[model samples]
Target: MGHERVHLLKKIQEVEFAAVELQLFLDTHPQDQRALMEFNHYSRELMMLKQQFEMQYGPLLNFGFSPSQYPWRWIEGPWPWERQY
Candidate 1:
């Protein structure tokens, strides 16, 4: 795999984990303003990272999560998430 792709995937994974963790924390402690702020930050960052990945390497999702491009994009082989480390 290319270095750029690997780097981006790793970063996306980290941000995704942070966002989900913060979300769970907020669910249990809704009064924690700092956690809420952090969650929001990570959520936005994750969205941007997904967008970047999709724009560069095709859809980062499947089953209608990503918009279809000309010639039906996701039908191609080796999706972004399918790359081996």
Candidate 2:
């Protein structure tokens, strides 16, 4: 993979972990304002990261392509099992 792809992948993985961490914190301390803030922040970051990844590499989820793309370019990337993250 190129440097851009590697960087994006690393960033996406980092954001995913941040989301998971926030979820775990919120699970035990559901009313904590700081945890809630962090959760929202990470969630937004994840969305932006996913969008950038799709715009560059291909859709990681379903909504990014059009009917004109036919079979969908989303499937072009590494499959679920093929992905490490």
Candidate 3:
């Protein structure tokens, strides 16, 4: 579980980074269709990965980024930085 969680989180981070980079590129090049397509693709991919992560483990973020279960899940351990690959 721990190893899988770490791997999944890494994927999420990588996709998110790509999305953000594409967004920045688009900001200066709005006419670039390829960049826009890639940005949207990464955005959707990031959302799916995040959902999978939260469901299998717990909410990946707080302050409305991800919802908690009956009790707050934001406080659980093995947080992103604490996980070992």
Highest TM-score against the true fold, candidate: 3
How high a TM-score does candidate 3 get? 0.91
Better of 1 and 2 by lDDT: 1
Rank the candidate models, highest lDDT first. Answer: 3, 1, 2
Model 1 TM-score relative to the real fold: 0.89
**Mind giving the per-residue lDDT tens digits that candidate 3 earns over 1-85?**
4778888988998999999999999999999999999999999999999999888889877778788786777788778667565
Estimate TM-scores for all models: 0.89, 0.76, 0.91
Q: Of 2 and 3, which scores higher on TM-score? A: 3
- On TM-score, the stronger of 1 and 2 is 1
Runs of candidate 2 with Cα error greater than 4 angstroms are 62-71, 77-85
Residue by residue across 1-85, what tens digits does model 1's lDDT show? 6789889999999999999999999999999999999999999999999999887777878888988678677877566667766
Per-candidate local distance difference test: 0.86, 0.74, 0.87
Worst 10 residues of 2 by lDDT: 61-70
CA shift of 69, model 1, Å: 2.1
